[model samples]
Target: MPVFPKISLRPEVENYLKEGFVNNEVVSASGKAAAERKFEALLNHLSHPPSFTTVRVNTHLASVQHVKELLLDELQQVWQFNGLSVPVLQHPDLQDVLLIPVIGPRKNIKRQQCEAVVGAQCGSAVLRGAHVYTPGIVSASSFMKAGDVISVYSDIKGKCKKGAREFDGTKIFLGNGISTLSRKEIFSGLPRLRGIGIRMTEPIYLSPSFDNVLPSYLFLQNLPSAVVTHVLNPQPGEKILDLCAAPGGKTTHIAALMHDQGEVIALDKIANKVEKIKQNALLLGLNSIKAFCFDGTKALKLDEIEDTEGTPPFSPESFDRILLDAPCSGMGQRPNMACTWTLKEVTSYQPLQRKLFPVAVQLLKPGGTLVYSTCTVTLEENEEQVAWALSTFPCLQLQPQEPQIGGEGMMGAGLSGEQLRQLQRFDPSTTPLRDTDLETLRDARAEDMIRLANKDCIGFFIAKFLKWKSTSEKDPQK
Candidate 1:
């Protein structure tokens, strides 16, 4: 049973998405009937959680086996329910991956006396194994006290005002929980906020919280995000570039993969986001990453004798590899009950992404790798960009990915079937979970977990290209 119905969207957004699925040539070619079915499946799946929860055991600091044992022990202690053991399985393909099935929409959880309203983002996090943080609490019962049992509701429409006495606007029931703080403590004077306001005891979805749980030995990252790092494959002793890198999830992963060897330059347009990158690097103990606040689209050096070792505006062919995880209309994010973006706002990312691509290509050494990826499902952002790139740059050729867990590229961009095969796309709607023996999953290998993790992920696209030896038209190689 689904806990939430297929996320309700504004009429305009719904019509826009429906037209894309019905009239778009790429979707029509997949067979109109099949396309419609897939769209429905996407909607259904979006309202629910993924089949497995992936945790990247920080093997850089702790051994995989050791972390696995510790996590199992912790799960037993934290998630004990009537002496019944909750299964914590290791991923078959990724060595560091740990999988835990979410037990959800519990049959019997009585509504409590007190009520706490949270915003949609906080509600989604609660569904996916996160405890309610202090700031997410929007409104609480006037008489609510510490340890009082309460039922949480998510204000999906984002219309609920903070510190309200009561809310009758739009909201959804999340689950039952116990208040960790009194109403006064949660809504009083400055510096009143100190700790967790609510502790979820009977969440609709049952998954262990990873908060402060083996922070150094494990990172709670989505499976597709992990795949992005592996596909980039940043090697040791090489200089790499990550454009639009913020909050430093992939940036830190790259540095860790390189064993903290060589320079990993990370750039983001926002100054505050750059600070977050540095903070994540410090927390992860990665010293090789150098993050700067600069726009990647304008990262081209015009001077003959520019500073070679500084941030951005670098000379051509400066990096061995570049990752342009460009921003886009994040329609693929799950549990998004509503999106207020206009069509114009949603279609505005392509030009910016295109502007950044050339800089990334010019900054790469001859024979260097450039990976362009996005967490989006739009044709304009994914396949169409690949088509445009191939036609624009004679030196660039789509290269095959090492671990191709996602489906091939979708068909609307005039790319050939073989060309599409070379690209990787993690379309959550297409892949289905396979049932394997319990014992087999328990003793799964690292490669198996990586494979499984790759397939079961958010909608994403990855296109890797290798620059030719030379770009000059008069070259003998040409």
Candidate 2:
């Protein structure tokens, strides 16, 4: 059941998205009414988490089956401790992917009188299976003590003043939880209260928290993110480059797919973020990854002299494959109740993404593969970029993905039907929401959960291109 209204966007932002959905191509393909319905559906789905939690197994250390067994045992112990049982599923198409059902909108959950308010970011994390930490707590009942049951609300408008006694601005109830610290302990002269502030005894959506669970064998990741690495299809002994790699989710995944035998150079401009990539690679026992703090767009050198050591500023076509998971406007993130960005801020990423694309193409070897991806749903960033690349580079050709689970690329970018077929886009709005009540959720089967998991993922876009020797060498205008 739909517990909340569609996500609240600024009037201008809403209008912008509405126009994107009801554009000429979309309306001509699907009637105006259908396009309007999809646009509204997208708004609603953005406020809810996906129906399942996706975990990517570290196949470099253990087989998929082995990891699955260990995970099953660990989850079984957790469920037994909670006095409940739930199913852990392995995706049929994705080899190293595992799924866990999320039971939600639980009916008849009693509300409490005392309330606790949290920020938008904290609320989103809570909906995705995290407890309320002290730093996230914006307000609490003045007289409430530890062990007190309290209602939780999200400051939807971001108007709540930090450390305020109470907030009367726009706020939405998330669920209920028990206070782990007294109000005084959280706000008073305690040097710092950093751990969990509230234990979510009852949440609107129910999903298992993966904190400290199978740290070495499993990685909590979005389904489409895992797909990006698979589509790259790294080999056992090839050199790869990951541009704009930070916190290294996809970079580490590339190393695992290659069985830690090849050199994976990961680069990011931020020094702290580069450390995070190195940390993840070390935690996963992947030594093939070499991380550096440098801007990827400036990685190319015009010098004729060659450096013996394999590092940045190398010759053209130095890498066997390249992954440009460019930085984008993250409009596709789930459980996002509000966005305070202006129209200019929302559309500012395309130019930077385009600047990074040429550098990726220059680094990729002839007969190499390059995958460009974004976690946004706009046409300008998704399909328009593909159209731009195909026109600008004569040697590049679109390639089909092996396990194409998502829908075809969206229209309105002048892309042919065949070109769209080669792209994969995981769009949650296109999938109709189930019109069942709480009872249906209580009795949902494993198969139904699995089906929902595949379709109800974040809005993401992926396009793969293969670069061959340029034909212009033979014919100047070719």
Tell me each candidate's TM-score: 0.90, 0.94
- RMSD (Å) of each candidate, 1 decimal: 3.5, 2.3
RMSD of 2: 2.3
Across 279-329, the per-residue lDDT of candidate 2 in tens digits comes to: 999889999999999898887766758663777765678889999998988
lDDT of each: 0.79, 0.85
lDDT, candidate 1, 280-321, per-residue tens: 788777899999899888888878587757777788887899
Worst 10 residues of 2 by lDDT: 78-87
Report the lDDT of model 2 for residue 390: 96
Global fold similarity of model 2 (TM-score): 0.94
lDDT of 1: 0.79
Clashes of 1: 9
In angstroms, how far off is 333's CA in candidate 2? 0.9
Q: Which stretches of candidate 2 lie over 4 Å from their true place?
A: 79-81, 188-192, 306-308, 435-447, 470-478
